[model samples]
Target: MSITRLSDLADKAACPRLVVKVGSSLLVGPEGVRRSWLGELVEELAAARARGQDVIVVSSGAIALGAARLGLEKGGRGSLADAQAAAAVGQIALSSLWAEFFGTQGYPAAQLLLTLEDLEDRRRYLNATATLTRLLDAGAVPVINENDSVATQEIRFGDNDRLAARVAQAARASAVLLLSDVDGLYDRDPRDPAARLLPLVEGVTPEIHAMASGTSGSGMGSGGMTSKLQAAQIAELAGISLAIINGTYATPIARALATGTGTLFLPRRKAAARKAWLGGRLRLKGTLRVDPGAEAALTRGSSLLAKGIVGVEGSFERGDPVAIAGAEGRIVAHGLAEYDSRECARIMGHHTSAHADLLGYAPRSAVVHRDQLVLK
Candidate 1:
């Protein structure tokens, strides 16, 4: 829907859920974590919670804080190993800051550290989504950050902006608020005297991409206007609205809501049926060859039954995404596996009722549930 006012994000029926991304510059100052600014932001988030909105925070500051604590220069952590070490040290500090500030407002904050694998792997993605749902259901704010300590340079997002968009997709959030150094997207270089801020962006077109600047000059933060643009594109594909605003001021979120002060990027359409990630975003781990009956059943929107499955290919774990092949090895659909490949091999021609006797445990009814399937 259209959201001309930032206040619309606070409405439960209208927006329901939101992901707020706080940049390292905004979170950790020269001294340490900006407690005063964070406290004010927490107060605003608490108000949103009172309004029945589920709030998730994607914060960047671990490396910045760690560098300061380790007596390293702002950009002194030159190696990947050094940066990862700093992240290990700073994660504890960053998490505590979030907990302390949110705790004061009577809200419990839950920390989630994710690497690229967590989002790229189907099983981990499901697990992360479940945990986020449970935390929000319990009225806790989920504070998320990339797991830099264990993540290699090849696997790191290196920016919280894109992570926030992925979190929005995972949590099925309606909106994302990116608090950065600049107020919003500008028509031209923000440093230019004639530049003008674009308040509402209908879509991230080529023109929009042209307006984006490079990464931040500030050594403390990695993301800049370009990363924010990438985040907007991700959110748009997930049918989540995203806004970027300068959070240098106190109570930035509250102020944005009150004055509609930001660049709001609207989604082109709603997310595809079920999760957009489940459609074609994931890498399939295995293949399931089903008989004619199963293929027909699936075509009619029925779950795949074990008795109708004839073969299993490759290795995969429960909750992993797999391809369902029909006649002539043509893939009919893709879905999350209810059972692992080895288990599927044993029960391929057996009925669900015999699963307990064969596997020595209770089993899920279907081999692949229709709810988790996307027809190809």
Candidate 2:
């Protein structure tokens, strides 16, 4: 839970499953796609795969690469239309390049473009996780990036760093690596030459934050040390370990996982696949009323029961997160409903033993199974 311990975990992570998010700055430097760096990344990823690790890459640079290829001198700085157009073209070319690169190495890479809505919506989020799981199981690497073209503000992933964190939570990855231009976070701007790199950040205290100056330059990339830290915070909350390191360095991805060097953010508490999935999103669909005793039991980490349910409101089927409301109509927890709205209403206020007779259905578990619940 302490950043002090992050490095040790980084060193020992053996991290059977990993997620690496690459920034645009690392992809297209002052020149073009840093072929050497890209090669090192690919080789390292391949090596990890060979070592029995499943890896997913959240890549940025479709727009940058597309604009460069299209000879668009003014890209993102230009009109929105130009930016979207560049992203569309770049996404196609960029994905093709990745497919070809990984294919030659005998590992296939699949491109997945997600908008912010995918993570905000619980069902859609699960679908995305399922898709990625299938890819990892099939021994294919999933390359995720924001859908820059079609996505507007509502569904946009503001930055790839944020997207990367969400992806880590979605996949329940034990570790999340953020590859950028900066080597690591420094107490002051490293450019001053007098600044110093803080090796271990146990927690982003007020003093530590004061040390974080302006956005550290990332050349063509939107994220800086500050943004990476924010991503780390988000990833950490869901129990995903995070690292920010220099992407240009040879084998940066694999090396960081090997604890070569980086700023590591440790997970406060690692959640299981189901808990991680449920806890990551708090959006509620409906409400479930519980008695005072039921509230106590559920809050104490006990499973839900029909005996606890006083009522059900709104419309949501099985597996949907519904707010667990107390007698006073205050929400105490959010959990996946075991039955549909009508079914839950019928089973409400009844004891668990009577589920089969009243509902004429052989219920397997409680009203809201503990595994499906996310306590507030």
Candidate 3:
């Protein structure tokens, strides 16, 4: 569906669940937090909530706020420790501000700080999903952010854009609004006189991704057009639509939702809940290599048994997402592992009966239950 104007969005049915990601540059200023802009945004979100829509906000600005408080320069500077310290101090301020803003609008808000582990581990992922779902069900808005205070470069989401996409997938949101400095995608840099804005994106193809260039001009934000495109791709695969919109104006969230004044990236197709979860995984804890028989069984909707397993690669705990590969070393499916890597190695080629004697405890029979597996 091509959405070139805000009227296009108004003609369509209202989105049931929405995820809005606000950039640090939009929320933070050199003087301090932009209260007026934030209040407007909160009012817009509250209106959506009043209309019976679930709204979640993935906000950036902790580090920016912390930097401002410490009188440090923004952008890529200082050590990991310094960044962590800033995040620790800034997150408190950011959360408090959100609470106050949402409170004034008569909307309850909760803060969620997540790390990579929260999404990769099946147990934690489910827990987070349940919490978010409960909050939405209770008419509360969830204000989410990366747990930058504890996350390192290796474990962090790197940008709120991708984290918002992940959050959308987890929450099963119908749409995502990326509120940033840029209004929408362009054939070329929007700063150039010849550049043309792309109002609608059917998919994030290689050619489309190629159009993105440069970082977010704001020294406070980490993501640029490239990251937003990456986020759109992720959202598309999860059966969610994403839009990049200019958030400098008042009521940006309401405007984007009502008028579609942004580059709307449509989902490729609808995905089942299990398929969405499988496709949206950003990290795989390990890989389980199986024989031809096991691969065939998996294709036929059978559980991954230890008897047909050939190898276990990498270290992972129980309930962690793992890649299931076939004899040809191609990933055939993704599933939550019932056993750890070490246990799987020991039980490989063994029957379910032997699991008790080998592991000293009788756990589940299958390495990965059929219900938990999603084929690639």
Candidate structures ordered by TM-score, highest first: 3, 1, 2
Model 2, span 263-304: residue lDDT tens: 776655555666655554535668888899999998788998
Backbone clashes (count) for model 3: 1
lDDT of each: 0.84, 0.76, 0.84
Candidate 3: the clashing residue pairs are 6-259
- Candidate 1 lDDT (Cα, whole model)? 0.84
Point out the higher-scoring one by TM-score: 1 or 3.
3
TM-score of each candidate structure, all chains considered together: 0.74, 0.70, 0.76
Residue-by-residue lDDT tens digits, candidate 1, 1-376: 5455567777788788989999888887777778888888899889889888889999888888787778766443587877888889899999999999898889999999999789876578878899999999998999999998898867778788988988888898889999988889999998899999898898788689899887785767777798888788768767788998879999897777778778999877554735466643435789999999989999898999999999999999998889999967977788899999999999999988899998989989898998888765
Q: What would the TM-score be for candidate 1 when compared with the true structure?
A: 0.74
Q: Tell me the lDDT of model 1 at 94.
A: 92
Candidate 2 structure, TM-score to reference: 0.70
The backbone clash count of each candidate, in order, is: 0, 0, 1
Candidate number that wins on lDDT, 2 or 3: 3
Backbone clashes counted, model 2: 0
Model 2: residues with Cα > 4 Å off, grouped in runs: 1-13, 203-208, 213-216, 254-259, 271-376
